[model samples]
Structures are given as C-alpha cells and as structure tokens.
Target: MAIDFVRSLRGHPVRPPASGIARRTSFWQRMHVDPWLLGMLLVLMCSGLAVLYSASGENVHVVTAQAIRFGVAWAVMLVLAQFSPATLMRWALPAYLAGLVMLVAVEILGDVGMGAQRWLVIPGVVRFQPSEMMKIAMPMMVAAWLSRHELPPNWRALAGCALLIALPVGLIARQPDLGTSLLVAAAAVFVILLAGLSWRFIGVMVALAGAALPLLWMNMHNYQRQRVLTFLDPESDPLGAGWNIIQSTTAIGSGGVWGKGWLEGTQSQLEFLPERHTDFIVAVLGEEFGLVGMLAFLLLYLLIVARGLWLAGAAQDTFGRLLGGGIMLTFFIYVFVNIGMVSGILPVVGVPLPLVSYGGTSSVTLMAGFGILMAVNAHRRLLPR
Candidate 1:
C-alpha cells in the first residue's frame, strides 16, 4: 500500500495532494497530545515520590496515601486532556457556578481543620477543598465570558470579571484560607490580563487595593495579622508564633549545597519541621536534595510555564489564548507562593506545592489546570463543529 501511494505520487513530478475540501482535523488533535508537558509532569511526579519517601519516612501510611493520590491525579489529567476546548467551554460557567455554590456551602457548614474551614465532607470518602475547583473553574468561566466580547475595552466586562474573581476569593478568605483564596483570585486575574484589560486600569486597581490594605489588615483574624508581623520580624516570637518559619529557615540554611541526602534530613526526620509533607514540603527538598534539587524543581516549573505561554501565544482565538495563558501563569503563582511561604520569605498560608505536595484536591486541581491548557493548545486554531 505504501509502495503504491509512492508510485501514484510519481506522476507529473508527484503532484501533491491538496488539503481540505474537508478542513484538516489533525491540527486540533495535535494540540491535545502534549508529550513534553506530560513528560515534565511525570518527572515532577517521580521527584514527589522521592521527596515523599524521605518526608514520610516514619509515616508509612502517608506514603501509601500519597501514592494513591498521585495515581488518581495523573488519571484525572489524562482523562481531562482528551476532551476538546469546546467541551470545556460548555462546562466552564456551570463548573464555576457550582464551585461558587460549594464555597458558599462551605462557609455555612464546613468542617474546621487546624483553624481553617476549607474542607467539605462526603460520607465514606475524603474531605476535599472546594476552593481548588474554584481555582480551575474561575479561570475557565472568566475566559469563556470574556471571549464572547472583544477584549474588555470598557469597564463593564472588566468589572464582571473582577466580580467573578472576587466572589470566590472572598469566600475562600472567609474560610480563612488566604493562600488558596489568593491563588484563585490570581487565576482569574491571569485570565483578565490575557483578556487585554488596560494597564492603566490595572494600575489604578492595584493602587486602590494597596490603599485598602490597612483596612484589610484591621479586619484580619488575630493569627493572620500575627503571620504578617512575624514575617517582617520572625525573631520577635522565637518560641511562639514564629516557630514554623524559624525552623524552616534553619533547615534550608543548614542544607548547604548538596544537602544531608535523601531520608537523612535531620530537621524533617527528627520532626522539627511542621507540615513537612504538605505546606512546607520544600523544607524536605532543601534538607535532603539541597540546592540542586530545589533548582531542578524550579526548572520543571519554568519549563511548564514557558510551554504554556508558548501555546497561549500561538492560540488563534481569544478564548484559547486567555485560557491557556491564565492556566500557565496560575501555575507560576502556585510555584512561587508555595516556595516563598516554605522558605519563610512569605507568610505560611497552607499553599501546597504543585505536583509536589500531598493533597488529593490540590494535586487533582493542578493536573486539571494543565489538562485544560493542553486542551486549549490542541484546539487553539480550530473550531469544533
């Protein structure tokens, strides 16, 4: 069959077959198959396995649970990426609205954990974070909405986008999960920025937001205020509110260049580091894998973000571009804030390191965001009939 086709092509100097009386379908399909991004994710997952093995050394159950989480998360990403952007667009608003309802529900009847109301329980299953859904859904909703109109040259669409971002942000904050709230808001902001909102308007918004910080500070929970103050002067409460930061910094500093080696991290092994598997997983990486490992982790993040941006830039439509760009930048926010909080450069706010931290909701959420990006990339130039 192959020889026959080649022979057929020989006539008239191999008159080439022309494209699309039927609109070539391959371009749309091509974006959905992202081996590079998927490979990076696999590497991240493997690194997570190594880090978790050390961090969860004494807690065998922790390793088991996390393995299960990673498996499920990868599966979710695979399943999600198989869908087209049209399918995702159809779900965006409904998904966002559902997430919003859940967020509101969380406020009314949430299960409190470690001084935060961030989880919802379903009988016989695990309690998961509703805000994670908001993170993904908010961006999709905003992107879908803005794609309907031209870039927000007017205030109304911009305000609508802001309102969409803010409602979930306010709800997450009310749950006292400032980290997730900030992330969710940032995801929507990424979409808004990709929507081409004016820089002058953005600056004015920033100025107004900064002006309101004092009032915001006044309304913050006592512990929340202490975290900000502690970030500025960690020494002020050495044995008190600042213990986590102080210990995290000590672990990172002591790691030196090559680190203490895997499973040999004194701070993590000796249990001096709190939340070593969750919010502060970086301490384990710093203590064991050291600076080299940290850089590797960062490089993975950089690659993922760069690829996402490239896809967004190549997208042929506003929705695909905004959606891809938004998800890409949000991933950056996750990397930045998680590492910043763990390194004690920013307040500890329970932000999980993407693909590295051990949380079912978070892992799935991050993967789903990537999956959406893959979908957008796949369908950037084509429309689904």
Candidate 2:
C-alpha cells in the first residue's frame, strides 16, 4: 500500500481531497472545541496549580484535591460545549428557573458557613453553592429573552428583564451573600447592555442607581456596612475589620519588583494573610512571582477575554453574540473585583481570583461559561463553498 501510494504521487504534488480537508477542519467544530481558548485556559490552570501549591503551604492533599476539582470542571466545560446555540438558548429558561428554585432551597435547607447560608448539602452525596449556578444562568436567561425581542428593550421588556434579575438576586441577598449577589446581578446587567440598551436609558439607570445608594446603605447588614467603612479607613480597626486588607496590601507591597520567592511571603507563610488560598490568592502570586509574573498572568487573562469577545462577535445569531459577550464581560468583572479586593482598592467582598482561586463550584462555573463560548463558536454557520 505504501509503495503504490508513493508511485501514485509521482510527477504531481500530492494534495488532500477537498472532503478530507473539510473533515480535518470540521473535526474541531464537531468536537466543539476552540484551540486558542483552551490553550489559554490550560496556561492559567497550570499556573494556578503552581501558585496554589505554594499558597497552601506545599500541602499535597490540598493540591491533589484542587487537581481533582479541576478535572471535574474540565469535563463539565467540554460537555457544555457539545451543545448547539439553539439548544443552549432552549436551555436558558429552564436552567434559570432551576437556579431560582435552588436559591429558594438554599434559603430553607442550606447549611450555614462562616456567616452565610450559602451551601446546599445532601450529607455525603454532594455539597455546592446554589448561587454559583446563577453566574451562568443569568446571562443565558437575559440573552434568550432579549434575542426574542427588539434591541434596546422597551419598557415591558426591561421590566421583564428586571424581574428575571431580581428573583435570584433577592433570594441570594436573603442568604446575605453580598459577593455572590453582586456577581449574579452583574452577569444579568451585562446581557442587558449587550442587547444594545440605549445611552439615554443607560444614563437614567445610572441616576436611579445613584439615588438608590442611600436605601441600599440602610438595608445593608451591619457587617456589610462595616466593610464599606473599613474600605475607606482600614487602620481604624486594625485588628478587627481591617486585618484582611492591611495584611493583603502588605504582602503585595512587600513583594517589591521581584517577589520574596515562592512560598516565602511572611504574611501568607506566617498565617497573617487571611484567605490566602482562595479570595486573596493574587497576593500569593504577587509575592512569589513578583511584578513580571503578575503582568504575564494578567496579559494571559486579557487575551482570553479578547478572544472570548471576538468569538461572541463571530457568532451568527443574536443570542450567541449577547450571551457570549455577557459571559466574557462577567468573567472580567470577577478578575477585577478579586484583584481589587485584595489590593485594597475595592472592599473585600470575598470574590475569588477566577481559575486561580481555590474553590470547586466557582472554578466549575467559570469553566462552564467558557464552554458556552465554545459551543457558540463551534455551532456557528459554516462559510459558503
């Protein structure tokens, strides 16, 4: 067979048949994978594992467990990517509804942890946060709704969107998880903005938000209010409300141009830095990897965001475009909030550092959003022959 093929190719440059070429091209689309996006995610994931090992005090068990979670999350992302855009759109409402029910369940049946009722448990079966589900569902819900309606939504559409956003957000606030509530609301708002919300309407909403601040302040929990105040003047209660920010800033600042070297930061290694492995993992990365490593990691994240937005634009349908944009922008918000929180520029609301932060549900949710982006990209209309 080899000799015959070699003889057949004599006197002409061999070329793959057009069908074979298409088969090669369509393999990626068939599998619903985006190579560039996947490559970036892998870099972040691997970098996260290295940083996590140091942050967790070089504990094998901690690293192993995180590795397991990444495994599961990676599988979930690929599974989500296998669906087409229409199927995803069809799923949007039901998933949103299911997420709402889960939020309500968290209110009644959830376990209390730290200071919030955020986790739902089934004894040895499984335990997870319900609000994380909203991270994906919110954008899906709003995008599906907006895709069916006009651009720059009308009053009725806006009201419908608000109602959709408020249900889960209200339930989450009752859980008193301000961090999650803000993220969920942010996801929904991004979708609405992508629906081509008008500038005049945007200004009006901004003014309304400004007016609502007082009411919001009045409604905040005492601890929540303290967070805001502490953000303004952290040293006022150095040992109490201020410890986290103080310690975090110290860790980042002490890093200098080049870090103290991996696992060498006194704040984290000495247990002075709060939530070192989770919400403030950035401080760990900053301390060990220094300015160069932090800059490289940030550039990688920005590339992922840029690519995600480009995929959204490449999507032929309105639903894919809006949903994809919503997911990507919300992802950027997560990175911003977590880094800002740890750096003391924003109040610590317990937001984690995207894939780098240690957590099962959060990591999975972030990956699943990328999966949706993959699906949108893969299922796009093929070009004419």
Candidate 3:
C-alpha cells in the first residue's frame, strides 16, 4: 500500500497522498483543550490544599471540604463543555428564570451574612449564591435575547436587556455583596460591547456613570465608604480599618523573589493575614510559592483567557462569540480584582480568586463558565458548513 501510494504521488503535481486509516475527529476533539487552564487549576487546588492546612490549623475540615468542592467543580466543567452553544441557548432562558426566582427567594428568605442577604441555604447542603448564578445566567440570557433580535438593537430591546442585567445586579449590590455586583456589572458591560453598542453611546454611559458616583456613594454603608477611603491610603489606619490590607501587603513583600516555601509562610502560618484561605488566598500563594510560582499561575490564567478569546473570535455565530467572550472576561475580572485587593493595589472588594479561593459557590460557577466556553468551541464548525 505504501509503495503504491508513493508511485501514485510521483506522477501527480505534488499532491499529498492520503493515509489508509480512517480517522474520526469530532469538533470537540479538534478544539484546543487549554492545558494551561487545567494546569493552573491543579496548581491552584494544590496551593489551596497547602494554604488551607495552615489557614485552618487544628481543623483539617477546610481542606477536605475544598477538595470535594474542587472535584465537583471539575466535573461540572467537563459536563458543561460537552454541550453545544445552541443547546445552551435553548437552556439559557429557563436557567435565567430559575436564577431570577432564586434571587427573589434569597431576597425574601435567604441567609444574611454581615448584614447582607445573598445566599440560599438548603438543609444538609451548601448554600448557593444566587448572584453567582446571575453572573452566568445574565450574559447567556442577554446573548440569547440579542441573538434573536436585530443588530444595533432598538432602544426598547436594549432597555430590556439592560433591565435584565440591572435587576439582578441591583439585587446583589443591595445584598451588600458589592464584589459580586461589580463582577455582574463587568460581565454585562462585555455583553453590551459584544452587541456592538456604538462608541458614542459607551462614552455617554461612562459620563452618566461618573455623574451617578456621588449618589451611589451616598447610598453606601459606612464600612463601604471606609473601604474606598482606605484604598486611597491604607497606611492611614494600619491598626484598625487597614489591618487586612497592611497584612496582605506585608505577606506579599516578605515572599521576595521565591516563596517562603509551601505551608511555611510566616504571615499565613502566624495568622496575621486575614482571610488567608479565601479573599486573600493569592497572598498565601505569593508568600509560600514566590514569584516563580505566581508567574506560572498567571501564565495559566493567560492561557485560559487567551483560549477563551480565541474561541469567541472563531465562533461561527454572534451569540456564541459574545457569550464566550463574556464568560472569559468575567473570569479575568475575578482573578484581577482578587489579586489586586490582596496586594493592596486595589480595594478589598471581597471577590474570591477563581478556582483558587476556598468557596464551593465560586468554584462551581467558574467551572460552569468554562463549560460554556467549551460548548462554543465544540460547535464552531457546525454552522452552515
């Protein structure tokens, strides 16, 4: 067979000869799996395991719980990516409605934490953050809605989508969960940008946002206002309002070129770093793993975000592209804000580091977004081809 193929090729104008084997490759199989994402996730899990051991000293339960959550989240990511974007679109409305109802339920009868109602706790299981669901659902809902509508949509449709995003964002903000609220807002902005809103319109909205800042400021709680002021100058109140920021900055600086070694971080071990296993987990990774580990972790995130962007750009349909872009960009915000706040470059807004922070709700939600991205990539060549 080989000799015959070579002979056949010799008489042709240099055409490539086909192999005898029949390969079966699905779109799913062809997609770039983003190993960097997978690697980063594993690194995060391992780092979490190490940090939680110290952060939750004398209580091994945190690490065990986080391990289970990580397994569940990975499973969810795999399952989500297996579906196509069209299927996701079909499911988006129903999911959004269910999420909205849950949000309403959280408002009416949810657990209040730190004076904010944001979680739905069921018996014998973990409490779910409805706002997290809204982060995924709102984008899908809008993308699906806009996919079915005309381009440069009329004011009415735009208003409807804006309302869809605004309603949940407002609820989350009122939950006093400003971190998640800002995330939801950022996701919606990406969706709006993908929908092709004009630059003039975007500029006008930015101006309006600037004008509304004072009114929003007035509505903020004392602690919330203090956070902004402290962000402006964390050293001003190092012992009181600024303790967390001070500790976080100190931990990161102490790590130097390389980390203090996993589980050996003085800040994390001595318990000086607040929220060491949650909001400031990145600081733990920094102190223990050092700059090299941090760079590797960031490279993984860069790959994840880049692959997601590639999928969005390559998507055959507008909805898939926008949805893909929105999901990945939201992931970016989660990482950016968490690390920024931890390093004192930004205010502590309480956003968890995606997949790294010890929280089931955030871990699961993040994986689901990845799954959606996978679905988009799996169906890239299926449209009118």
Candidate 4:
C-alpha cells in the first residue's frame, strides 16, 4: 500500500518542509542510528546465522567465518551511518570512480578461482569483489548526478544515465558475472524509475528488450544459455544441467507445510542439493522450516522493504529519496531473485539470499546500503550536507 502510494506520487515534488520547519531530533536520530532498522538487522543476522549453521551442515568453522564477516560488516554499516547525506554525496563521485578503477583492476590483476575473474585478492589482506562496490556506488553516482536536475528527466538526461550504468554493467558482464551485473544495473535503474521516468518509456524499453532477446541469447556463454534451457525444462537433463533445480525443488516440496525439522532435510543433510550453503540455501530453509519457515523469512524481507520505502518516502531531498529507494529495491531484487531461482521459477543466476547467504563482500555492501538509509533518516532535518 505504501509502495503504491509512493508510486502515485513519483513525479510530484517531495513536500518541502514548512518554512523553517524541522522536527526535534531524537537521541537516536542525533546518533545517526535508526533503532528500528538496526533491531531488524540484528534479528536477521542472528536468524541467518542459525540458518547458515544448518545450511553448512553445522560446520562451526563456516558459521564462525560468516559471523566474523557479519561483525565486520556491522561495524562498517554503523560507521557509514554516521556520515551525513551531504558527506556521502560529496564522496559519491570518488567512490564511483574508485569502484570503476577496481573493476578494471579486477580485469587486469584480479584473481581467478571460480572460473570467473571477479575477485581482487590483496594477498593476505582481503579477497573481495569490486563489483560489490558498484552496488552502492551506482545509486550514489546516479542520484548525485540527477538530483541536480528536475524530475522525470528528459531524453538527454536519460542517455547520460544510461552511459553511467552501461560502463560498469559492461565491465562486470565481461567479468562473466551475469548476477552481479544485473544487480548493478538494477541499482542505477531504480534511481531513474523513482525519478519519475514515464511508463510509456518503460514500456518502450521493455519491448526493445524483448526484441533484443535473440541477440542477447546469441551473446550468452554456453553455461548461461544452458541455465535458461534448464529453467525451461529441467526434466530434460534431470541429472546434468538440471540436477540443481530438480533437487532443490524436491527439497522444498518434500518439506510440505511443517518441514522435516531444522538440519534434518534429506536433500540438504545428504548433499543432494547443490550449493546448499550459498545460492540454494533458501531450499535448505524451505526444507527445514517448511512453508512456515520460508514465509517467516519472507516476512522479514518485506519488513525491511517497507521500512526502506518509508525512509525513501520521507526523505528530505531528491538525492536521499533516489539513493534510499534504489538501495531498498536492489535489496528486494536480491531476495526475490535468489528465492525465485531456488524455487525453479526463474533461471539460476547465483544471487545469494540477502543476509541469509554466507558471503563477506555481499553482506558488507548490503549493510553499507542500510547505513546510507540510516544516514538519510537520521539527518533528514539538516540541509543535504
């Protein structure tokens, strides 16, 4: 309901504060902390850690590693939250430029471990994905640029935004990471969407996308094409290209309404589901907690999205609205695409479940975004900077 209402007001100017009007800052706001969102994140982290334990087959080593990452990311989130939106906007371009450079560096000096050159290892320092940086930077860059202009940007502005988005998307896709590229693209696009891009134009773009499918298919790598084919008919390959989907769906279906019990799912515990700790972990969730467990996680995700949208709707300036909304929607896509792929409804693209999946850079990027959201909410009364 709030999302729809926000959509209806898309092109309208954000209600300007009454002359000299400002709400009294609460202790939480002054501290740049959103107690509500922080509480939600804490609950999510704990729940996800529990799920990760079961998903990793109760591997304390893996669980401990993920917890450490969560702690590091949590610190990063809180620290970023302390910066005002003006400070964040000031650093936006530099961050985006740095992200692009790192992406290029990834192509040049990045490591190769999982058949794709998407990681940059600082040799005993840290191994991370440069593309992850773009997840936050893309929105910041777009919002920074467009917030200077009027709403429902014209063709020239749209073209400029496209260039900004395409450069990184091209680089990341060249890294052969379809999932990350889609996410990076989504972040930039959400900014445009919220800035009031017209439905007619969106329809035209959708049609163009449809028309280009053949070309897109031709350009896809063999594995990428195979994933689409498997999505269409998993039974054809059942044990080969389709094993993941088949097993994952079975794991979910076998759980029925109440599930087999935590750490007790046959597909996960017996190693039948591929990537049980990462991409397909939602299946582990479904199989263990059943429909009820799956719905609980979904509810958590919905709460996050709703809270994020509320922040976006209440943002004092265009930059805050676009950046906060973009971040939230991108987070939404992370949850949707991961769960959709795991359930066999969408082609697998290797998107991990938001806070639930075990990964360092992903969690950091995600938390950093919420931190930005907090910054926007906390500093709403002050002028942008």
Question: Per-model C-alpha lDDT, please?
Answer: 0.83, 0.90, 0.81, 0.91
lDDT of 1 by residue, 1-385 (tens): 3544566567634334465254455543654657777888888888887798787765778778887888888778767877877788899989998998999989998899988888899989879889889888998999998988766646778878778888889999998887778888888888887777677888998999999999988878999889999999999999998988998888988898889988899999999988888888898999887898798889988998898789778877777788889988988988898899878888877788888777788888888887777777666544433
Clashing pairs in model 2, backbone N/Cα/C closer than 3 A = none
lDDT of 3 by residue, 206-308 (tens): 9999999999999988889999999999889999889999998888888888988877889888898888888888888788878887887787788778877
| Candidate whose TM-score is highest | 2
Tell me each candidate's TM-score.
0.90, 0.93, 0.88, 0.92
Q: What are the clashing pairs of model 3?
A: 259-290
Better of 3 and 4 by lDDT: 4
Can you tell me which runs of candidate 2 are displaced by over 4 Å? 1-23, 381-385
The sequence of per-residue lDDT tens digits that candidate 2 reaches over residues 1-385 is: 3543475668555556656653346566667888899999999999999999989988889888888999999999999998889999999999999999999899888999988999999999889999999999999999999999988789999899999999999999888988889899999999999888789999999999999999999999999999999999999999999999998898888898889998788888988888899999999988887888789889999999999999999999899999999999999999999889888999889899988888999989999999999989887744322
- For candidate 1, give the lDDT of residue 11: 62
Model 3's alpha-carbon lDDT is 0.81
Clashes of each: 1, 0, 1, 1
lDDT of 4: 0.91
CA displacement after TM-score superposition, residue 216 of candidate 4 (Å): 1.0
- List the candidates ranked by lDDT, beginning with the highest: 4, 2, 1, 3
What TM-score would candidate 2 get against the native? 0.93
Error of 1 at 123 (Å): 0.9
